[model samples]
Target chain A: DAGITQSPRHKVTETGTPVTLRCHQTENHRYMYWYRQDPGHGLRLIHYSYGVKDTDKGEVSDGYSVSRSKTEDFLLTLESATSSQTSVYFCAISDFGSGGPYEQYFGPGTRLTVT
Target chain B: SQQGEEDPQALSIQEGENATMNCSYKTSINNLQWYRQNSGRGLVHLILIRSNEREKHSGRLRVTLDTSKKSSSLLITASRAADTASYFCATSGEQFYFGTGTSLTVIP
Candidate 1:
């Protein structure tokens, strides 16, 4: 346990509504990542932050925006939720970029349903 | 995306049997890792094999990395019913990219 937490472990929202998921960490690691997992699709990166206010788009990063205001908090906002966006979102933290890096520590994950 | 392709999308085997899954990547990787995800949960790191390491063992888990083949294999010996879950192999390059994954079913 890397002291990682994700808000609203489960949620259901209407289509076209905006949703924001939050990830908080206590380790103050330099690397934080957002990933979405769907059946048969495995885990796809949505966005990752190397440090506060520094973020990068991931492979499947279209329709999603992220902000890292502090080292402990990373926020992901979906401007308009769609049914196709229904999936489990995971947040991970690691000290991968500083120098010697290792495995990622994953949070509990958030299950979002767009109806 | 550089996502690895896992062979045998789904696998079913009896308990006490050995389960094997293969992952093939495109780019040169510093290390290859294996993660296990239980239903509706986040991923858990299992083991990692470095570029120079040919094989590594952690308990019943065996991981093999072949840079020449650009491929890797994960072998779970004497699998148990609790081992039934989705197994994914990820290679780290610019970042950690996951494979298609192998769904293993260990029947009792």
Candidate 2:
């Protein structure tokens, strides 16, 4: 299970409002990722953290930002939620890096609705 | 867009039949991983095949990678109704990119 949890399994917020989704892990993995899944688009990476305080932007990372203050916690924030930003978000953790083929453990996920 | 493309997009087969799905990606990769997602749930890792490895097996799951073609295929043997879900292939390099996914429906 990798002991991963995501806060607010479901959320509904108005457009222009700010929303923050949290991901916590117990394994203290070196890599944490944020991804969004929408119909026809599958999963798109938003942002990822390689370590505490070390993060990088992903393919679809325009409106989102992430922070990893601790090895167990990674946060994703939407400065101003938009209708187009509504989607199911997922968090994943991996113990390895680009050096090898390592599998990732995923959290339950967060479904956000922007109205 | 580094995202890979999954073929067929959807598949259906009777229980006990073998099911296969293919994924194609661009650019080089360090490894390829397959995942399954049940409805309304997070993805579960199924298997991983490194760039140096051609094939790997985990239980009923078999994965093959062809770096020369930048493609990979996943085969599910002796499928069961519980195996019905969305399958995705992700390529890992400097970053990770996921395919659109193939939805498999196993009839009982």
Candidate 3:
């Protein structure tokens, strides 16, 4: 599906450095989300955007921030990357008005490494 | 902080054999979904069973959800080499929570 796409498929950054990962969706869905996956841990939501300029944090949003300036874009940024932030990041989109079910489509995922 | 947890951390079976994975959750949910991920990639949605539904089928995939037990099971019939991947079960509450995932290896 041509719904979602994440930029910088792979990245490496140093601790205390700022990092930003971009997520773009063509479906123009009303909901977008960012998540990180680590070994022994399943995907954990970092943040989500319900509409343009509207966003909310998820479970692991301590060092992360998100911005949604457009309906098709959601950006996840790390104020100061830490070694613990090294993991795979995935972007997903959903239709809150679908009234069908909680079906979310995920992107290819970006691998981030912070040393 | 996933609400659901899957059992049998890993599973391996011969092609054409049946493989089953279990998932348990902590609280009420509107629906349960199964997704498959290949290696370090993103997940692909497989099937979704609502709280009121018991079982659902799609191709060789069969998913059963038991709200009473707050658990779910995924059965893959006629497993194939192409089915080798990690399967995750997720539940929906105020947010969606995904399990740690069950790794399935199918040998040809």
Candidate 4:
């Protein structure tokens, strides 16, 4: 366990409603990431934060946005949820390591359903 | 996409049998990692192989990396019913990209 926790482990919402998922880490790692896993697509990064108030978009950032106001928390928000956005979302954290491999620790994941 | 591609989207084997999964990537990577996810759960890091290394073993799991071929393979010896899960390969460069994954079912 990486001291990582995600809120609302399972959620179901209407297509046009806004939904937010929260990831909190107690390890104080420098890097935190949000990813979505779906059939045939595997896991795709949605966004990541390198530091507090520092974040970047990922490969599939079209329908999602993220915020990291505090070092321990990273939040993913869907301004208007779409049925296509239904998937299992995971949060991971990793520390900055020098000269070698860095391993990421994952949370339990959030299963979202947009009806 | 820097995502690696995993061979044989699904696999089914009897307990005590060995299971092998392969992953192929396009770009150069610093390291390749394997993760296992049970149904509806988060992924657990299985093992990691650096680009310079050819093979590594952790208990019953063995990982082989072939940088020249830009590919890797994971072998689970004497697989058990508990080994049933979806396995994914991820490559790290500027960012980490994960493959489609192989769903393995070890029937006991």
Per-residue alpha-carbon lDDT of model 3 for B24-102, expressed as tens digits?
9987887898999998678999998888899999999999989899999999999999999999998875467889999
Q: Model 2, which residues run further than 4 Å from truth?
A: none
DockQ winner among the candidates?
A: 2
Name the regions of candidate 1 deviating beyond 4 angstroms.
A97-100
DockQ pick, better of 3 and 4: 4
Please, what are the lDDT tens digits per residue for candidate 1 over residues A71-107? 9999999999999999999999877633335788899
Model 1 achieves a DockQ score of 0.58
Instruction: Give candidate 3's error at residue B106 in angstroms.
Output: 0.3
Error of 4 at A74 (Å): 0.1
Docking class of 3: medium
The 10-residue segment of model 1 chain A with minimum total lDDT is A94-103
RMSD of 2: 1.1
Interface RMSD of each: 1.9, 1.3, 1.8, 1.3
> Candidate 2 has what TM-score?
0.97
Structural similarity to truth (TM-score) of each candidate: 0.95, 0.97, 0.96, 0.97
Full candidate order by TM-score, most accurate first: 2, 4, 3, 1
lDDT of 1 by residue, B73-92 (tens): 99999999999999999887
Pairs that clash in candidate 1: none
Name every residue pair that clashes in candidate 4. Answer: none
Give the residue spans of candidate 4 off by over 4 A: none
